[model samples]
Target: MEAQARAILEKHHDNFLEDGNAVPAPARRVVGNFNVDDAKPVARRFRSIRPEHLRKAYDQLEKLFQTELIEYSHSEWASPIVIRMKKNGGDIRTCIDYRIAIQLIKLTHYPLPLIDDLLIGFESVLWVLSLAMAKRLWAVPMTLWAKHISVLICLLRHFQWTKMLLGLKNAPPICQQMLVNCLWSFVRLPASEAAQMDVDGLAFLGIDVGDSAEEDLSTLIEGMTVFGRNVPSSPQLNSVRGERPYICDIGYGTETWEQLCVDLDRRLYRLRYWGTSVSLLKNKFGKKRFSHEIEADRIQAQSKIAEGVIDLPSPSTLRDVQPFLASLNYYDEFIESLPVIAAVLNKLTDEQIRSGRDLGRAMEALRILKRKTVSTPLLRGPDSQKSFVIIIHANPWAACTVLGQESDGVFIPVHITGRVLHDHKFRYHPAENEVVALIRALRVFRAMLAGTKLIKVYNRYSMLKWICTSRSLEGRCRQLAVCFWKFARFSWMTMVWPQSWELRLPPPRDKLDQNDDNIIQVTGRVIQSPPVRLETLGPRCEGWLMSFDGHAKKSDRWGSAGCILWELLSWDVVQARGSHFADVTVNEAEYHGMIEGSKMALVRGISEMVIVGDSRIAIQQARGLIQCLKPRLRMLLSEFEDQRQEFKSIELVPVKRGFNAAANYLASKI
Candidate 1:
């Protein structure tokens, strides 16, 4: 019967081998009981029906079946009618048991969903095959047949069927490769006995095995563990040194599949032994959860080691020397004693030390000497009699010296070195010695001038003249003279004369303008004051400016308002003030206001600048500390930085209240 079916298929295949439009005579002849070929004449009855016309013919056939004129049955002879309909361009109903054909083709071994997904283009063929498989009417592998049909459908859609049928059209190389791979995937193996197969059979269609052919089979067995037989026992397997047993049918050709299957069986045996060994090891040395107390103990030990509180012998040190070595906790004392120990050791020659019958006794003597030398006190005075002075170098050439005095009135100088000024050079001046003496004298004078007692100097005019002349001394000497006079006057005010007394002194004035050739006039109002109470102002009042000048054109007009702020404040906070000015741009104006406000705060010795403005641009700019980018604003920015150095700190704040009344008033007047 199979041979007969093959012959019939071959004949039909030849008929549609060229155009694919011609219906097989044998198949069409069995469509209905009526001998249409004989009655209507072959030429007329064999006329190919167009697809549109086939629909009408199918409807008529449906009517005939409904009227009981035709029967639908599970018989191969009944398939001829469907084939005739297909030949006539009609939609043939899928066979109810088409899966039987799929089984015969050996395509059922694969997962059905995978097969379905791969055969989406050949849905009709798959449907027929699925029906046959579900009904057990076919022994074919439904998945395998569906895959082939999918390739055929793809080819048919891409090229003319007529050319394909005639052999004039060739199937793509991929389609042929897929068919060969599917065939290899279909080969069956016995239940107990393993079969050899190629790696390609298990791989997806169109994939090449390449150098990973062996690995592919191993991976396949590992993935399909449930399907494989029990593994063999071996020490290699137990140690995970051997491959697992699982066949990978990943390539075409009979030999490849056979080799793959052989590899799979061997690998599985090894994997089984490995799994068992792993289980045994795990059971023997399994991890256990510790109680909180135990965990805490472990953590404490770890932290001690990390912090170097617990000493572990150094890994790089000689093992024999480890026992004799002391803990590193007394590092300072240990280092201090090393030189003394070396000196004592040098006195006794190595031969003499070795000659000592007991090495321990010799080592003990050396240690005693080291301890005595290092433990000796360096200072030999009472604690109250000790004094130290710290000299902090602010610049390479200058240092600020602060002295410490003992109860006996002895002064000691302590040198100060920090990361910032370690490499700095300071030139000691004679004035430093004078300042030190003056500090000591001031202390003694304060003690003698207790209460409101005042002693008039024998030469008061001469002393005043001397002090005034001393102030004119240049550089370090000049600074020293000023410090002496200031300290003396401060002592007088606080100790000698309790009443308000003023020494006649020159009034402070701005340095004469150096650029007399290009003098420029500036005009502005007193827009703001230092943000501090008068009594709280203290020594800072001397640096504060009463007003800021806004000039249109000046020799220093190129400078930024921000830079001017820094110059006036003498504080680093000026950098934090966002300010700039440009050529009449709104951004420039806003930036200028922000910077100027910050500078005003610094000049007033205020910790914060509260900038209040109705202009949204100015408010946002001030709030964000935005800088102006206009070319004209660069100079303003420079000026702001120059003026910022006077204040200790400055902060920016936005305000909507009348607190900025002065600034607002100035803006209006401008």
Candidate 2:
């Protein structure tokens, strides 16, 4: 036992405590002051104490009194201490709970410590981040003194990240924020062997820096130096004394971002500094911003191919369609609604575009759509840290989806994919076509889509619902549904419907049907369908923007219809109505109103119209998708069909309920 004791003493010979040795008072006395003149003071009544615990508590009190940690108090202020078991469960600890006294004590603020002043006497100062966990050695009875230390600690933390005040050279802003938010405090100790030997001298007053401090510190330093470089000796930047300027406060200019790019490029050249590259740092910090490396490549590619369609001549023969389509196809990923815009071009092949007026109009529309697409923003590359939104739109003729993301609260396109489903095998119900489009999009962009959280947006509510459900699917649908489940296995996936972005979806990408063969079976089971001869007006085809509204009072058994047309060229709004239509439901009334508007356009020799309404049922019915089961509605649909034939082309689109306020007001007056 004696040898064991000697060995332990030998292990910590420098740390041995000597008998009757008092710790010397600090050279500078720590003073605390509070402006408590306006505060009220109170004294608590002494409560009955437990006899056994009282002995332990009184013993602690006597020790504190003897050590000058506490004194006999005849003042009005009195706070009690409680005896509690220590963590080891072998000893009692006296804890002074100052729950009430702290509140009554008036607040005080300490001026921030000056770093240069703090280091005035030292030749060279080193920052030692001690990883030692702190332990309170003894409990001192509560007094006005201890509160000052608490306030001092708060001041230290408040100014921890203040760079100019802290005298931290070459620290980055991000590192400053991280250090300020850290759960640790700093202390100053004299650099000596004796101080180093004393464990408490190096200890943190509050939370301790854990084992991860080394890694954290290294990361902070790396972040600080990632963009660091030597200052140039410019005469304009130097003082008259030829000394370099000491810029303590940071101010950013437009060139700051460009400098960051240059820094990143230089860092990348070293290869060892790649860990601090923009891409890696974004991954490290989970910042949903573009990576410097990937965006550079994408921008370069865009600039190179931007002029592919610029020199193309007018297409008079089938030979010209391929070159135009190829140029349009090169930028397919930036365009939304590509299938709709290029429907005419998609249907025509080298053998298909015979001399016809429709072909000429289709070619002209293709050129207009292509020009619009080129003007859209460059596609952003996929980001792992950011959540993506895939917008899918499909009509009977084609299907498409666009990948997008919300960055800095603005949604921007990432990639677009779409194709005209000229093949019969790919054709399905419009609802099914929408789902197929989503699945196709997911498959094509799986490299980017994988492991990213995706929000799927669709214009058709039915399609969104069908994709979200797993049951009642069969054959090809079941297969597509399986792929969807796999797609959802990404980091996360969500569904959003009928999105009209305040920042709209990306422009349309024109895709041909023959491009994708992966969806086909080995046995050539896929059949080709004759292109649906959609008698649609070209984009250049002059059309009026028509709006219709219908009103009905079931009790009165009467309905009203109102129509308005804004001429495409003249911008003249022509209004028309057929009110007091007897024995017609509101839905039938809406159909008649649109038909009356079309007839009005026909009378004015307008061959095309893009009709808009707030009624989804009416719009879908007019598009020949929804069946009119009611007798009067079916008769009105027949009459509407007859009027629709009088024009070269017509489109019925649904608007929000309150969108056509003028039309609604006109209908209500009837």
Candidate 3:
């Protein structure tokens, strides 16, 4: 493979392979194209030339000349060239500062494959022993007109590339399109190639570019695509991979099925954990449950160190270090300490080529990462009906977060993550760090936590709002405050002390200060599992009771809302408000009436009141039992929260429609 790569480099180093034939790109094929937004031609003078590196810059120009990659040009468009030394100090790189030129570039955008979609399902589990990338873009020829955009001003001499080169923003999508076309034209076996199979079955084909007919490494078909036992039930992309076991009908495919099942289960578990409204699938999931604690011995078999996967003997360059880090990054959400364990490798990313090569330290970090990946505990699936618990821990070096949920009687982890602090982050106040950690975790787990219940412990829920309102803060804190606005609805909450707490538990059959069979059955398993509520207490004001209801005709866009505030002792109405709405949902009308009732209470200077409503969803949201996620409802809830501050104590009570007839009649009469 190495010899084939060297041969390709020597022969067609500046050529792209043709899709039709197994030969070098025959002509100047402009796969990627761009147009200037305006008629003006952009030009800039050469800059950033160092006195000590002048000779190396000239040597780089000479190398490009010999490779025929660049030629003299008289184009009006010119980007300045900057010179920098290579990490080894033996060579120099001539780079272009294309900032100004990029302004006029009419961006040609194509949808590159998303990393999330690529890292999901069957593709992520495949074993890849070796992977290499050759400079295939060099073969993509530049059009005569487009070549002007590539012109660079070096020492007042303008030059342009005859082939595709770095610094062009549109090169990636163009190269992707060309490679896709080439693969589509490659020789492919029939999907049902049952008759073409040899008696000994099939062997995976490993292909090399620029290979001859006499070579054993040549696939003859021109390229290699990893084939599996059976097509996945879900949609999949054709990704290149090394040799893996294939399935045959002769009872030999059990291993492949077993491995696939494990991988598929792991993926589904994560999807469930990350989803906001996941429900338990009775038929798909068995009665099995994960332990509250993670045990290394119980991890799945596939997680163990596979033969060739984590064999990081020695990686001398950042290029070598990056791919392995990317492979481990797939386990980021699964392993909490990933950022900490790989801190040294992450620290090594910006190091010079050979100057900071700590092979021993890097290898040790990689080895630890391998073990961490294997020992990661399985996460509990999310339940939309249950609330989510977020426990955040911050130290000097890192911030860790754990997403907790309850199943049956025990609490289990849904997801775990850690973010290492470096540079400016280390200078934050301790409380500031905690807020940073909280907001970061909230954003990452928004998919699961949004529109779900969160524990409103103390004033922590309002911390974000406080930060946003604060006047004394640095630019970083202000930036975080700006980002916090995007997630304001997802994190809004408040708290109530235990004295004001109201809970309804099952009545015990027998109790003598002991957990009798029928009495003490309630096991206080998960601490935050109970559904606690609050009610108005320890307050002396007008005993006001507010009942609200909304009415809408069948299939009508108009509605009416009514609210009545009456003295609880006399049962006499003190004030009543009715409003009609157009093009509003029933829930919206109900909220309108609820808001009207609160306003009336505030006008009467009522410090404590009980609010009753018939709409269950709006009532729950007002009582903090559920989240208000809809834009309109969220706005109404915010307005209600603002008005709620005027009262010393308040409670939202829900009643059946039949029992709220007084308010209903008032609404329908409007």
Candidate 4:
């Protein structure tokens, strides 16, 4: 602990040394820049005033300092005027201590002893003020006493003289009102009655209010503007100065007044600084006004309407369509002035352009329609019965058309389309493709509902791509929502593969059997074997199996046999791993194989795990149906039990089929 303390002190000492070394030269440079040499004699002469007058000046300086008119730290020579005046009584030691405390307080990095001492001094003054005000012994007005208290707080806070006015202490209402008035006066802004009421006087100065201070100040300013009369009186008020004084008096001395001016200047400087940065800050912090955004949106909607009208091909020759195409350019310019329409237009390209003559005719038809008309005939064929009609829906975003037929009376539907497009030159550009796809989908869905026997074509890939990229559509699209739910429901499905079948043929022991023909027969037999089999053995068979066990009794006491089989017959198909017949208990061997298999599945990142064991007891134990009796078996059971949770879904099933291929394969290998 001592070493730790030493290390911390050493670090701080180094920092102090670095700071102290840099201070003197800079201080001298600052004093030199001010050219204080000529003023030194005048200051010295004034310093020798009679003690009574000097004390008065000192009191005024103290009040001004408290009000923060002039910063003592920034004054020439390293001492505050309050400390310098104390030397007049020749109390050299006290004066030196006061000067040292002031200097120490001025060092921003140093702890402030002077502030603490000053607070103690202010506490004594507060006692005096309380007694004087309580007794009504002083001739000063209650308002004047409050104003002086306000000046004192302003002085203390402004000069970092927090010691003299600790934030924890509360001042009288008169003092509080006076202080708030003084601060507001420096702000060069009028105060509303509500603001004056809410200022709560000294409460504003107590404690660090953080961001709320700024908010409260802003509220006060806003209230003043909303409720109070404007400054620098209007023309009508110019003739009424005698009746209504321009400036009202709030109690403050000359020193306090000077300090208020200085404080006001500082505040103005800060406000200007903030004003200079407001534009950049607004770009980051202020949202674009909804009115401007909505106007842009409306313009875009109009452009989409115009684009749909102009893009339809003419029924006449291609040459006739040229006029309509030319007219589209003029319409485009007019629509572009509406920012919303311009935004949508900027997303268009040549590939999306349809027939201009059809669009122009559609627009002309819409214009000619009466106020009550729901649909307008746009294009009339030679037969007159055949015509293309534009259908206007109440919704601005929904408008469509029907292509007419003559004999059969069939009308093909045409829907307005828009999309967002991207180009390599400008990646991720917002074009009209998405909106176009949405229009097509809506049209198709509508046709389906209307009992139209039509195969509705849609841009499926684009829709799916949008669904995958945008989270907004994920909640709305049924197909995508179902896919996500399925993925989550069967989490284990992601980690494990379903069962597959593989033939297990033994290696040929004889040279003749090693030939391809004989090998094929063995392989065929292996493939033809039943998937599952249960064998009952006599007691003598157990000893024989132990003799054939290639491992030692204790060492081979626990062993695992595994086989992989594919479920080909059932819809709930799966891959299975299990153990075979052996000297070892089938249950133990099966459990071991399952544990090993689960680890492999985890490594492979399978979302589900399935275990198929021939032993009902083993399966029941795994599912927590039967408890293991032996400690060793219990330990193995515990380890193998929780493999299910590693996957999204897990299931245990018993298979009776000779078709249970995985277990059969394992038994045959044994």
Candidate 5:
């Protein structure tokens, strides 16, 4: 240990717990505040117990009194007491079940730390320290009202807990919240040490000296004193080896053994400075790896993820999809096609475009992503000091980018990423798509390229010139141009034609059909599907909007159909009509309403029309994207198709029902 650290530890000797129970947290806290939802609390009936166990309960209660952990209580909220033998089988433990009390208390939600993030921090380190705390739950105290509900009755005498206990649902998250608050300042200690040890601290960081007041020591000291008795202790590290866990059994590594000793000393010194002690028996220093380090046996963790060892199931709804992706994101660096898969998920997550036009395509993309994520070749770590080369591909659906560096005259990949495009982006000219892809790649990999200059970009169809010279940018395109120019200025970038064979990575396959393909197999980067173009209207009713709606009851097979068409030039209804259909389904009625409305336009010699309807099935079928499976529906679609030909130009649009209220009102009145 360093002399300074040793002096600090010796100065706060009282905080250290050499043996017996742990010293309480530096301050008292109301941890498990059991706020009841009801005015009166229900006292649960006592559960029957064996005579011998009842005697153990009484003995435990007397010990609680001696320890001042419990006191005589006068409250209607009573809970049944239960006695159980400790794991050692040497002593009995007593506590109230509090099952009913917990139901009455309002729930609290606080996020716990993630294990994958914890493990990723241990990548190149050679040494790690695992520390534990004794009786951590006592770190957060309970309010007086909380104590009233925690009553335990040993037949005659009633008692309540004076300190916080773990029986309530909110206890764990409350403890987590407190732990995060206390450790908020500790993550910067290494940087503080780096500034002193290195010749230039802020040179690489791109910042000036940090404020001394913002640096927190309590985080490190308090962190070493967590992982209380409630968290199972592992005397032998080998015994507790497993996959990732919720609480950090921290094994973050340093590059060398000497660095480990220094970090250990720093922690010890800080813990003593904060008036806390480390349980020598619970901490393990200089360990190879702990339960969470995927790097120790990366293949094992990779196989586990591929084998579905991660706790994820097929999502049944659109809202469940993002979290499912997030669950797999911890290991995304190891997945070759992360950006492409994320793009597919983004389509499902968007609420505005629920047109149901590309549902099957999204599902297929998700499958391709899953199959591609099975394994990947190891990638070189990114070096911020060096310039970077990016190979990019983009289409209407998704964009893929590969970031790499030239090492020993060979192209070495640092990272791969992909993302789905949104509304206006999809309609962008092919050249604009490339510009969008480039802008997204720059933002995604900005961390690795922080200080890098002279970025080299390559694409199948180079759009660097288009981005530079195009003064016709509009809306989304203009925003993308501003972003691109900023990055261009920052990096002094140049665009070059790509030599695909020079890089080791396989080109994205033309079709994403095979399951075992190593690279992200996006559909051909060629613009396979162009954005929908409204049919060109002739002289009559040239710029007009049409709203159509249909009402039908399955029981009676009777409904009314209506449509209203207005000229955009005059804001007046050129045509409005409603008719009843006695023997048609809802889909048929909706199509008939649209067809009747179109006929009125044809009679009025209106050659062009834009039709909007709430029925997705009707609009999709009219456009021939959805095949008609039923014969009656086929005939109605054919009639609608014929009516479509009469107009010089026609456009079919689908929208939510609430937006088509005017047409719907006319339909229901008929």
Candidate 6:
């Protein structure tokens, strides 16, 4: 590759640094009438050049004058020119300020001409143009005639050579070499004026004398239509010119598929299809193909290290103890309660401390870590054709999410990730933190999801509204929102409710009371998974009554919600209360209470219910009597409406605090 690149650069080396030859006058003559108005001359005073660089600048100006590239002018079009240091830091170069001259000239532009109109004029004499160009430049030097003959050559190249090369219908070996050589020599022409040196001053008249015409435009425009993969196979182009040997199958009773296999085997001895095996297939997909059976070597290595650490004698000095602790720390993710169990051993390793432990607690932690790792199930690799589903859980200090896909009628895990939210000053709301979890997970697995369908299954159902509708979030949350928008724009993505039965790997049932650790659960489990709150009712209940209430303290640190259900048949009442640290206002709290109340009713298979709340704003918003202009309130309102879909009818009624006393008392206590 490096040698080929050097050869290509050497081929075009003459096009670079030149002898400052001025382009001939014929190429510069504009072939159009200058009927547009001319502007008055504008002038500026020239600034003093730097004293040290004045001599170098003067020498450069003298070279330009000698080459006739510039002439002395006494017009009022003067502007300051600066001397700039060369890129190699060896010398200074002279530069001109053409701003005043540019301002004084009134530019003329013609309306864009249609290609069909020009093609009509050339339809009768296409061959005449090419022959005329070749005849005119036949006797002149290659470099001298290269510029003046560019317009004629551009027309011939675009109409003749480019068509022959792209269509793949020409006699290949001789024609390809001839056309390639002709185009290669054309690059030595004056490239700087190529774009403006058209047949006429009208640049958009379908005539481009630019280097791009000889180089890139033909390939770009002909890419899919003429030179694409599905073009019919030509023996001259593919077999002879491409240097691929032709293989023929002559057997009498063989099918085409059998003949292909036989020919391949004869030529290569053994035929192998790339990316066919399990390992190769996994690599082609570029996903995490986690499996214990396939990772036996890695597991064996870790097992040996663990056994060695276990058999070693207790360390008397800190140096001897450090290596063992380091080895155990590497496997901390698999260990449960690693920090508390290894606390004494970690203290012993501190540089200034001389104290030590008996290695009893460390041994327990290691044994547990080893056991857990041995029992851990291997996850499958991601499939690009399959849709991706992300299950997320978040809290104030930490967040976790699992990437999985449905396989064999089950949702199997592909990867799991979590991290501590270390930015303390940002103070992300719980919903915002959940959004952070989602964005972090999507970014981590972006490659696997490039053009795939993605579905986000969220624990906090209200978060779906914030992600899909709210446009007012700022700072890190807004950054996350943009990342989501980019992926959402190009891919098939949806935010939907998470079914209760969808959780296959629930959060650890044993860690219900360990809330202070702030450990993010990769699985869908919480602190004492709350049971479904069902309204206790009498037999054959006729109707249902819901009492909704909300609460906010004077300082607004947290908001509380309460809802009570009454079965009218036997006058039985069931009460439920919850709190939201993310909600800032009392009205938000009231909407949250109404949302949860509707959810409880839906879960109990109730068709209709009456929702009674103390906050008039919450009641009016739910009843569509008022619009919630605030972004967060609007999102909460959307969540309430989505939950309303599960019920036949939910009527909202506003009541005074005294009339809704039971639910208000429950909200205040929450």
Q: How does each model score on lDDT?
A: 0.28, 0.48, 0.56, 0.30, 0.61, 0.46
lDDT of 6 at 260: 31
lDDT of 5 by residue, 354-462 (tens): 4455455456656655665554555788877777888665655567677888776666778877766654565677677767667778888877776566677766564
Cα-based TM-score, every candidate = 0.15, 0.29, 0.41, 0.17, 0.39, 0.27
Please list the residue runs of candidate 4 whose C-alpha ends up more than 4 Å from where it truly belongs after superposition.
1-558, 565-584
Q: Candidate 5: where are CA atoms >4 Å away? A: 1-27, 30-124, 129-177, 180-251, 254-287, 290-331, 341-378, 381-387, 395-398, 406-410, 420-434, 447-454, 460-481, 486-503, 508-670
lDDT per residue as tens, model 2, 42-81: 3333333457666776675555446554343334444444
Candidates ranked, most accurate by TM-score first: 3, 5, 2, 6, 4, 1
Number of the top TM-score candidate? 3
Which stretches of model 1 miss by more than 4 angstroms? 1-540, 545-592, 596-648, 651-659, 668-670
Ranking by lDDT: 5, 3, 2, 6, 4, 1
Poorest 10 consecutive residues by lDDT, candidate 3 = 245-254
lDDT of 3 by residue, 1-670 (tens): 3453344333322322223212223122224456775558766555646667777778777767676777999999887776666768767777886755555667666556655444334332322111112344555567777789888887737888877765787777665544432222222222333223232222222222232232343344323321211122111223322112111000011124344343323222221111101112111211112212435755453432443455545666677778878877677777755665565566564455367553455556677667656553557778878787665544444666667665554446688777877656656655566676777777778788766645321222355555666565656565765754543234334432232111111112122113221121222111121332223322344488899998766587798999999887667899888999988888889989999999988888899988887788878887775667675676577668657866899877777778688999999899
The TM-score that candidate 3 achieves is 0.41
- What is the C-alpha RMSD, rounded to one decimal, of candidate 4? 34.5
Evaluate model 4: give its lDDT: 0.30
- Per residue, candidate 1 scores C-alpha lDDT tens digits across 164-261 of 11111112221222222222222212212121223322231222324222333454454232214223322222322121111111111112333333
lDDT of 6 by residue, 1-670 (tens): 2354344334323222222233222211111111214444333334446677777766765654464434444334334454567646669865544333333233444233232332333222211101001111111111221111111111001110101111111113222222222222211222233343233322322323442333443444332321221223222122111111101111111123333333322211100000000111111111112223336453433455445544666555566657765665444433333443344345444343335444444445445444544554446788988887776656555566677787765666677666655534137666777677777778887787777745646455467566566665546456655677655442323434335324444334224214323222222121222221223334565788888888776575578888888876775886575665553678878887887888788878998987776787887777765557775576577567656765788767676677788888888887
Q: Pick the lDDT winner.
A: 5
Q: Tell me the tens digit of each residue's lDDT in model 4 across 1-670.
A: 2354344334323212121101111100000001112222110101123454555555655654554433423222222222232324543211211212221121222122222232232221111100001111111121222222212111222222211221112212223322222224323222222132222221322212232323445444453331142333212112111111111111111123333333323322221211111111111111111211136333223444445554554333333434544443323211211211222223223333333422332333323221112122122232332332221111112112122222343323332222222222122212123333334334433432232222222221234455457754445466535433422121101111112201111121132123223212212211121233223222232111000011112454644456453322232223434443345554566666656666656666666544455556655676654556754456456555445545676555545535355454554465
For candidate 4, the TM-score is 0.17
TM-score of model number 6: 0.27
